[model samples]
Target: MKKIFVLDTNVLLHDPQAIFAFDDNEVIIPAVVLEEIDSKKRLADELGRNARSVSRLLDKMRGEGQLHEGIPLPKGGVLKVELNHKSFIRLQEMFGDVTNDNRILAVALNYRLEQEDLAASGTVTAAREVILVSKDVLVRIKADVLGVQAQDYLSDRIIMSSDIYSGYVTLFVHPAVIDEFYTYRYLAVEALQLPVQLNPNEFVILRDEMGSSKSALLRVSMDGGKLEPLYLSNDAVWGITARNAQQRMALELLLNDDIPLVTLNGKAGTGKTLLALAAGLMKVEDEHKYKKLLIARPVVPMGKDIGYLPGEKDEKLRPWMQPIYDNLEFLFDTKKSGDIDKILMGLGSIQVEALTYIRGRSIPGQFIIIDEAQNLTKHEVKTIVSRVGEGSKIVLMGDPEQIDHPYLDSISNGLTHIVERFKGESISGHMTLEKGERSKLAQLAADLL
Candidate 1:
């Protein structure tokens, strides 16, 4: 049975096309949602882009039919704008104030109550059910309190967002088994009984019984204890090399097209963003696998303020994107920082974008790198990913352990959530780089602090 999905304004901002994501289901856009979208349309960021997109989409649908009644969607669904004033009355009475969020919730509550009344009267309505879908946690909780069937938008369900795998696991194998793999080069599971927590392409260093001089690099295989070559490839772009085994695994995952979604976690100076940018440049500049190299990172600060940088838009962005520029300079072997700017200017194919402006744009055949993904909420990440057109690969890299957002942490951060949710899927892979290749001092500091 087709259900009535009442969309909240936050859901549309999280994904402008979310109205069409539900197959054949009737989508109801509350009248208050339009007011919310109109208010956000003036902002010059991702939110503004989404608000504009929703406005344009509604306009286009109006050409076909009236939105107040219902319009036929191209994807075989009914879309309607709910203008029920009864909901506004109910909302004003319940909440005592006409806040934007409360108004949206009121629309949902009215629809649910009407449905329940119809059901109680023994009338078999075609509307399967009324579900209030939102990206805001607070909104969903509010809906539940009002006795409505509220749910979070599943398009952003990357899972617990907490409890994401850190990609490093220490397995205590038998001393004799570690000895045999060193000499034989491959250890069969029959020979050594290890646990089942291992994954393919995962690296393990076999330690001796005494925990000294027994460290040997080994790759886990699908067929139980079968060990293979370390398989670190040297075909990396931008002259960047993996500083550690976990980095090697991360590089492999980033370069592999089969893995569309990759999540890299590490502390500062671990080179997660640098390696991803290098790989993207190589694929776009040399391999011609992609048409463009597009880099975007959240505008969150890391330990300092970016107060009042002088210049134009690009100059203002430069301060925020300096780390990316530094990596590009290192990759292009440019002697001076300005030389990297010249190279980027000369090659118009590469673009360094701010995550705030990625909404409502369809990026195709491009290698897109999203840095500092840990600062993004799950809703923000969904908004970015949904804009990916055909033949595009997006790599989300961040240090989950170093989130700066007050509302987000390791588990709730977008990067960690994507990694944990997409793990073991054929189209996605992840790696956590443990070894710090920045410097001896950096490594010691990371370990000690």
Candidate 2:
């Protein structure tokens, strides 16, 4: 049976290429959905970008064929811009008002009735399955009340929440493997009994099979041919040490100039941002491996209109970037409160800016840290990644369970998507920090409160 998939405006705004996702099926775009997209095409956010893309795609399709009748999609599906189904008399009698959502529901209801009529008259050869695709929860709920099939648009998701990659695995090995790993610092990949293929730079904890509580933190070689011991640092960064095993793994990836991309995820006080900043400072300031250290995060919980602040652009960003500044101050170990500002000015190798200015520039020989990256969409993350120039490293760190985006969640956010998509590659590494090392109170709050 051939199914008709109706796309909601939110689905198009979530992903502009959603029209062609259906395989060999009929795609329907309600006329009112276009109106909604038109109203949102002028904004300056990701939504605006997607809306314009959808508009351009529709206009290009019009040149190929008449959309009112039906146009052939490149993926063997038919795309139709539904007009003249705006009559909401049937819906108003049941669901009350005819808002944009209700109007879309009315179009879907009309499609169901038309299909049923064709089936009854033998005009249709088989049963037709009509489904409404939307990203809005309320729209899906309303669709269910009206006896319509609806589902969320998940074209960008690479994994389920429970199946998300954790970048590390535990193996029960012989006690002498730990002894050999400590003596020679490298173990052959085939020496251990494994269940799956290991990615480059993936961390592993080898425990004793005799249950003697013996373990070692080791990393898979970039060639996936051997397991190498972690380069445990004796000196701490600004009096901060890697308190847990995951933090040690994150530091290993961050400090390696060969790895161009790294991702870290953890809840509050897991030392993700703090550790990344520390490693970035070590690379840019001490070793001189990079020209500068640039840090940027999206301005969430408050939209990007900076007019209400009292001072200039930097001053406007002061409040939003204070958490970053606090970490820098802690790393620099300032005696007085105002001395950290002088240190930052003296170094001249650090830049703390907003994510808005990162779109159109080529950044080479720099270490870029994007904090709170889970709030970003997959497309936004792509834009940020494509701007990386030669000899540069980008670390994306965020807590997916703490996302603030209205349309994103733990499984669909860019942070999780990148972790899943870049797992087996040589240029990327990931770690999920489980412990909170800020303070006893903070750790207790993370666990109990």
Q: In terms of TM-score, which candidate is strongest?
A: 2
Q: What overall lDDT goes with each candidate model? A: 0.76, 0.88
Candidate 1: where are CA atoms >4 Å away?
Answer: 23-25, 38-44, 59-64, 72-77, 124-129, 158-177, 186-201, 205-216, 220-226, 229-263, 266-297, 300-370, 375-396, 400-429, 433-449
| lDDT value, residue 402 of candidate 2 | 88
Q: Per-residue CA lDDT of candidate 1, range 249-278, in tens?
A: 777777777556677788877888888987
Write the residue-wise lDDT of candidate 2 on 6-101 in tens digits. 999999988899998898999999999999999989988888888999999999999998998999988789999898564478678887876999
Q: Which stretches of candidate 2 lie over 4 Å from their true place?
A: 84-87, 93-97, 119-126, 301-304, 335-338, 444-449
Q: What TM-score number comes out for model 1?
A: 0.59
For candidate 2, what is the lDDT?
A: 0.88
* Cα distance off (Å), candidate 2, residue 144: 1.3
Q: For model 1, where is the 10-residue window of minimal lDDT?
A: 299-308
Estimate candidate 2's RMSD in Å. Answer: 2.3
Between which residue pairs do clashes occur in model 2?
Answer: none
